[model samples]
Target: MADTVADLLIDRLIDWGVDTVFGLPGDGINGLFESLRRRQDRIKLVQVRHEEAAALAACGYAKFTRRLGVCLATSGPGGLHLVNGLYDAKSDGQPVLAITGHTYHDLIGTRYQQDVDLERVLGDVAAYSERVMSASHVCNVVDEAVKTAIARRTVAHITVPKDIQDWPSSGPRSKANVARHSGDLYADAMPLPPQSALQKAADLLNSGSRVAILAGRGCLTARKELLAVAEKLGAPIVKALLGKAVVPDDHPLTTGGIGLLGTAPSQEVLEGCDRLLIAGSSFPYLEFYPRPNQARAVQIDLDPSRIGLRYPVEIGLTGHCWDVLRGLLPLIEDKSDRSFLTQAQQRMAQWNELMETRATRNDLPMKPQVVARTLNEFLQDDAVICCDTGTVTTWAARHILIRGAMEFSASGTLATMGNGLAYSIGAAVAFPGRQVVCFAGDGGLTMLMGELATIAKYRLPVKVIVIKNNQLGMIKWEQLAFEGNPQYGVQLQPIDFAGVARACGVPGWHLADPRLARGVLKEAFDQPGPALVEAEVDPNEPPLPGKLTTDQAWQFVKALAKGQPDRWDIIRTVVENKIREVV
Candidate 1:
């Protein structure tokens, strides 16, 4: 029933349940776009301002929907622009399919207009990368690319020559031996760990009186099982940033997030526990984990390679988080002494109090923490929250309370900037019925400011909150904390983001006074369509870690002594923040 190679490709994707695609249009991909135009009623294309936003939006779609997210781009520069987003998908283990156009077969090596080796250039980021050489190869290549991306939870790429896209659809050659593929592949069966392996993990968990459980993104669907296991062991739950919504922030046993943008309670629990159980998370920070050989550890992960990747474990169970946790539930015995859990709950309470005090501060220049906290108050129960990389990440991790069915994600492993708005756009496209919000820093928003027009074009009701601090807050702290040097090359020029949003036809608000934050945020969220709020926050407020090392303290002193421009202001704010905990 398909007329051309492009038509066949689109039909195959629709058969695989792909209802939407994120892309930018160009001449090289015009044939494919024409096919999309013809079948506009069946599949929709959410055109973006830049190819990079398209790819990032695809990554966001895959993260939120747990399905294959597809992105299309033209040849040469447009195709190359997808690399950064593809790397984000690869690093975070999300399923994404990237389709690119190539120069004509004869013009490939002649350096014709927009001539680039797309397949070769994309090889590093994709699990499967191939070029469609003929019309007969389109069906098989598209099928394989989708199947590989879904099964491996990684990026897959396909490059079709511009000329070949319009060729008449054809079957495999009849004269020679050839193979055909079908688009009805199913690869979502849940794998359970071997009974013996589960028993080993259970025995290790049961042996210790002081137990702590660390959960990650993989545990999103295993919340009930994770809580059951924790309750049985009287273990405190410590979540990684990606796993923020795995357990509610108000849960009694949860110690909040772990690592630099984490809580003191989580750090204490990991350090004091005699036994550790890591479920579905390969948290990369080794320093945040228990010291080597300090505790007997058991890890459960779908991928065997990631079982002991972060910490040494006595037993490793390879299986889906829900499957493995469900199996181990019956074997784990309940702890009679609730002392460890009690102490962790107490620390969590104190940490929450300290955080509340910080969030309530009415500083002359607004504190970023207050913005995140205020946004959290107005969030819908099931809001999908997207955060960018930088100081905004710290505030979101610390202040935003993930409750009900809310979902939170970012460029976790990639730690790339400029993805907040793109991810929010993808969320808005995928689920128009749900409330979507983005927390972006000044730098990250500046990187992808063009996407605001995309939001206006779609008229999606996404709330954009920009922490308008005129500096790269994260890099400034990193320079002082890690490099023991004063900040340099991190300052950013001030921009009226709200004014820019208004120019793009979205309702906008500028909030510089702390007293007007809640009211302005309410007005922005009340808008029926896309809206943005620019909160001008203080740049001197540092994003202090949960537990500061002595060397880091010495480095902070060194940087201050070396004459930072705002050293005195920074010291004053740090003392004021620290005083909240003691008082």
Candidate 2:
């Protein structure tokens, strides 16, 4: 008998250097699962309890490794379950490949059991989606899927019919077949901006007395070149959330994040700058940016469409950041002015002091900022932090400083809940030696509490810190800011996440008292395997931004007038926090 379609696909995956896959088994994918079992020596399959976890694991793997993350699922409901995680990958611009088993070829499109329009459903999230019909097309489809995912830095999907997965291969079976199909879509050649565009950008930056650089994830590979330009121009670097680790936080010219999750110094840099140099970030919040035409802007992006999307660009260099910056640096004049850089550094120092004070407060219920700052203190230099969406994002973005080889990521565009646990699983799986810590809120942790079982099963060394506020803290603040409305259904019953982790066979620590948080957290981190720390954080603390707009203040006032039972208490807490800011 000739080789089965599953054999060829497995060979291709091995060829692509994929050592492991995250997936769930279902009857529709029986043929594929059986083949995987037979090939267990060559490929490792991590059987997750939910298909969503599989997809999210893949997303987390891709983000942590910067490699193509692969996940698999069965037909119909199984495939649908992978949607959210796939969207998480797509939105974050991570490369991921999803394989799904479909109904038998003849059974497709005839109201077959467990059959869905896989391609159409995933088309929006995947850069490439295809259905494999015959063994003859298997190799080609697999090749295209891997290549497209890598080149586009997005999701690529392929569905294999149950019957077709067991069919005799029409193509060669081993490494020869894989080598023949392997092709580098992104070769050594890098895209560079034209001389005219480069020169014009240099001229604008050279003339400006106050220049600010905003870098994003796109500048990840060009850190050396980025710092050189910043130094030459004497510009303070403001990071987008994705760019948090691009430049060291303690750098003389570095002013933390630039939007609502940004620092006061970062806002100051943008407000006073004459020239704004944006690198590889399509930061969507335009209001937080310098107003249109307020500063001469130079944006560098590989995609031409994104060059002028957020801010009107006086000079747009449509090329890779490293290439464009390298060319532009030579033509630019060095600015010796230290005023902008010195002033930004001073503001950053003050902001740091203020944050430290808030983080060290010994409140009855532990302050979330204190937990965030405590985690920051104990984190290893190479720690990878996976943060859940909600107020947890604010604590992580604002309080945690990225330094000494640290990396932080969250569900950026999609902002999905329960991402911290899933992403941590992927990171731990991908980098078994590196410390993976997840920052989650009670709301987010409860959503995927089952993943603790996955961690226990794999014995993955992941540490999760739950900020147990018993409320959707972010939404509570939003309700007050947007409509001055007293929090409605935002409250959550207190859950002992650490106890849940213990029930799942992972170790747990409960910090009922905030003062013992640091000591308890250190013990949890010292454990050899998966563990959790459930710290009770103050529910009333709001994640106020660097600047609260007038409209937001007015809405808050109106809400207060509507008078909820605890309106006065809530108002008093808000006033106290604001007073701390002014003082």
Candidate 3:
């Protein structure tokens, strides 16, 4: 007898270097369930309570390993739930394949139970969406699904009909056949230009008095070459959010992040430089670019289209960052003195020093910066951090130092609100060896509270730390700045997140003292699993990502003295590098 379709698919997954697929099972995909059961030794299956967790777990694996992530789901609502995660993968350029089950091929148009159109639901977020309508189409569709995911570096949906999974296939069922990609597809892949372009790029740098490199995610593959090129050229490197791991954060030329919530050193360099070298970052938001025509720009990217997409470019070179950089390294003239580079490095050093001083400052209402550092101190390098959307994101983005050992995962682009708990579950389950932490706000946790059951049922070691400020913090701050003041409904009713954790077979911690935070954090991190450490920070705290308006400023003067800033009661509002401790 010929091999079954499930056997064929399993073989392909093994071929693609995938050993595990995350998802909960249902009757709709029984053939796959049985196939997975048989290959228990070769290709294991992790059953999650929610499809969302499964997708997110796949995202974590992809991010942590730089491999194509794989997840599975049954039909209808299960498939719909995967959309949010697929969007995350797509926007962030994570390679992940979402294999979902649909109704029998014949029953597709009849609107049977769990009959939603899988292709239509996922088309917006996925790089490619396909349905296995015929037994003959299985091999082709499966091959395309895996290849598309890698080539596009995004999520793709392969809807395997229930009927097809059990059908007979002409194969030995050894787990290697299903995963092989057609050879020709990868043949036309672009090759990088040689030393010619690098020499030209180096000439511009040699002529310029001051230059800096602004990097993005695209630099990951060629991080070493890019670093060498930057070093040889004496350029300070500034990263976008996606560019975090490109260079070691402790590197001398590293200027930190650049954007709306960017660090001061990055802004100072980008705004004031004579030449700005852009590489591998599309940086969708144009606001992140410097003042109009402020600096001459040179960009190098793999995709030709992205070169001038944001800012006007004086020099645009399209090639692989590694290849181009290796060539450029030889051509760059080493200067006798790097005075310009030294000044930029010093600015970054001051920023780092001030950042540490302010973040560790002891104050009444706990500072977010302090809170993040405490967590960082309490956790090990292998621990996982899943940060939430708003101000919490800024704190984690800026302060949470990611050593090479730890798994630092986040929803980068989509910036969805309810992802904190969900993403944490995914990260924890994806890497069972690591301690997983969710840095979320009260509002974001409430949105996906049901996932608490997902954690309790599986007993995953994912901790949730909620900031219980009882306000729509980011929203309230924006309204106060634009509309003149915080509005109604922005004030949230207090919920005992810690109590809820305790009720769900998990321990809880609630703390307000900044000094005592490390102890509470240690207790929470040290505890078994599934916990919440709620911090009762003042809702109107941190004049942080929180902005004050002209009226609020006037009110601050009317309420207090002339030199004092608007009081949030969290800490003194300061734009300088350090956080000032409130007396």
lDDT, residue 434, candidate 1: 98
Better candidate number, 1 or 2, judged by TM-score:
1
Q: Per-residue lDDT tens digits of candidate 1, residues 9-112?
A: 89888988998899999988988999999999999999999999999999999999988999999999989999999999999999999999998878998989
> Between candidates 1 and 2, which one is better according to lDDT?
1
TM-score of every candidate relative to the true structure: 0.98, 0.95, 0.85
lDDT of 2 by residue, 29-92 (tens): 8877887888888788987878888899899999878888999999999999999999989888
Which residue pairs clash within candidate 1?
none
Better of 1 and 3 by TM-score: 1
Q: Which portions of model 1 show Cα errors greater than 4 Å?
A: 171-180
Model 1 TM-score is: 0.98
Model 2's lDDT to the true fold?
A: 0.85
- For model 1, what is the C-alpha lDDT against the true structure? 0.92
